[model samples]
Target: MRKIKAQLFISLDGVVEAPDQWHFPYFNDEMGAAVDATLGQADTLLLGRRTYDSFAGAWPGREAAGGEDAPFAKVLGDARKIVVSNRRLDFTWRNSEQADGGPAEAAAALRAEPDTGAPVWISGSVSVVRHLLAAGLLDELNLLVHPIAVRKGMRLFEEADASVPLELLSCETFRTGVLNLFYAPAAGPGAGTYEDAKTHLPQH
Candidate 1:
């Protein structure tokens, strides 16, 4: 089955909204390379309605301009996109589809359709991601935690779902002070290391 790799640009306080306003000061060539690498790794993009609309509106125009961003724009424009939305989505973008259902069910059904090996990349779709996390449909999460705290934006996990345990896969600190934390869902039960520690201690 194909894995769902969810990526987010988050602040120190866990805010995941409007990164374009604060994310650029910390963006560097290193981070750009990482982002580009991620885009190259995915053949499919999973998005929420808002994100799908935003990208579909902007990236196509960017691709048409044939500028420095044109290559990435073309990549995004050509990739298969699955948008989760209850609203009717008459998508004009190429290779786009809509799932008028719950996020988990839609994502699981997508992943189960043969082994593509390439991951399904989900970026900037927090609500859908939360649902996927709750349903254990997400295979990996990549969070670019910036040093600044917006303090008052939409949070990534604002009681939107139950707590989901994650196992750290990798951590990289960029030159611009951004922390890239990669994680996957913890496998099996009893994942907590300090559970019932009193019983494991010496019975003195």
Candidate 2:
């Protein structure tokens, strides 16, 4: 079955919103390469309605401009896009369609399909990522953690959500202070460690 790889550009303080405003300032060749490494293998995209609308609106025009971004624009424009939305979605973008159901159902169905070795990518779709992460359906999570702390903004996980333990796959720090962290849900529990003791304390 094809795996799901979710990518997010997040701040040290866990903000995931409006990456366009704060993201580009720190972007460099290193960061660009890291992004490309993920985008390169993917033939399909899993997007939230907002993200789908944004990409459909901008990328086609960018592709036509024949500029530096045109290559990536063309990549996105040509790839299959699966959009998740509750409301009616009359997509104008080519090869776009609504997901089968909610995030988990849609992702589960996608994963059940015959493996062609291509990945389904999640791009700037926090809600969909959260649902999949909570449901234990996400295969890999790639976070480009920036150094800055944007104290206030939308976050991927809220305080109300329970903790999800992850096993780190790889960690690389770029020259620009960005950290490319790759993680997957842990296979199983490990022997209790010192940190586990803290949770045993009686409630106050």
Candidate 3:
């Protein structure tokens, strides 16, 4: 099965929001290299509506600015994207498709691909991530935890139905107070258990 990996940047308090001020400023050569290395491992990008909108607006401009020769720009331009959104949208980017549904359905479709060589990456979108977590579709998590604390913002982890066990795969700390932690679900039948019922929680 294709692995569904979540690559996120979060605050000390688990807030995954606009990290430009705290984390984006510190994207040096090492960080760029790390990002490139990580992206090299994944061929498909899965995004939520908000993240899809943000990226679709920015990446195309970036690609134009850097021209076709830019490495990151090329990757961003060529990579296939599957966007999950309830609202209607028309994707202009090549190899991009928008699906209306929850994460579980979208993930199941992605996982059902004939070939399992390529990896599917979830960039951002807490709601979709939560759904994937509850559905046990998430395979690996790569979190860049910033040291700064945001007193009030959206948090990455909230109350779920039950606890899910994750095995630490690897960890590293950068000089800019950002720690990279990789984790995978503990191996077992009920390793990533959660409530399977349909319910709603107020947005933050």
Off by over 4 Å in 3: 67-69, 187-204
lDDT of each: 0.88, 0.89, 0.78
Tens-place lDDT per residue, model 3, 40-150, is 556788889898888777877777787643657568668888888887789887778886476899999888787657688888777888888778899888888878787
The TM-score, computed over Cα atoms with residue i paired to residue i, of candidate 2 is 0.91
Q: State, as a TM-score between 0 and 1, how close model 1 is to the true structure.
A: 0.90
Clashes of each: 0, 0, 0
Candidate number with greatest lDDT: 2
Model 1, span 39-155: residue lDDT tens = 756689999999998899899999999999999998898899999998787989999999758798888888887878788899999999888888889988999999998998899
Cα-based TM-score, every candidate: 0.90, 0.91, 0.83
Residue lDDT tens for model 2, 1-204: 889989999999999999988899889999988878877556899999988888899989988999998888878878888999998789777788899889999899889888877888998899999999899999999999999998889998888646788899999999989999999998557568877988898879
lDDT, model 1, position 141: 93
Root-mean-square deviation per candidate: 3.1, 4.3, 8.9
For model 3, the local distance difference test gives 0.78
Which candidate number maximizes TM-score?
2
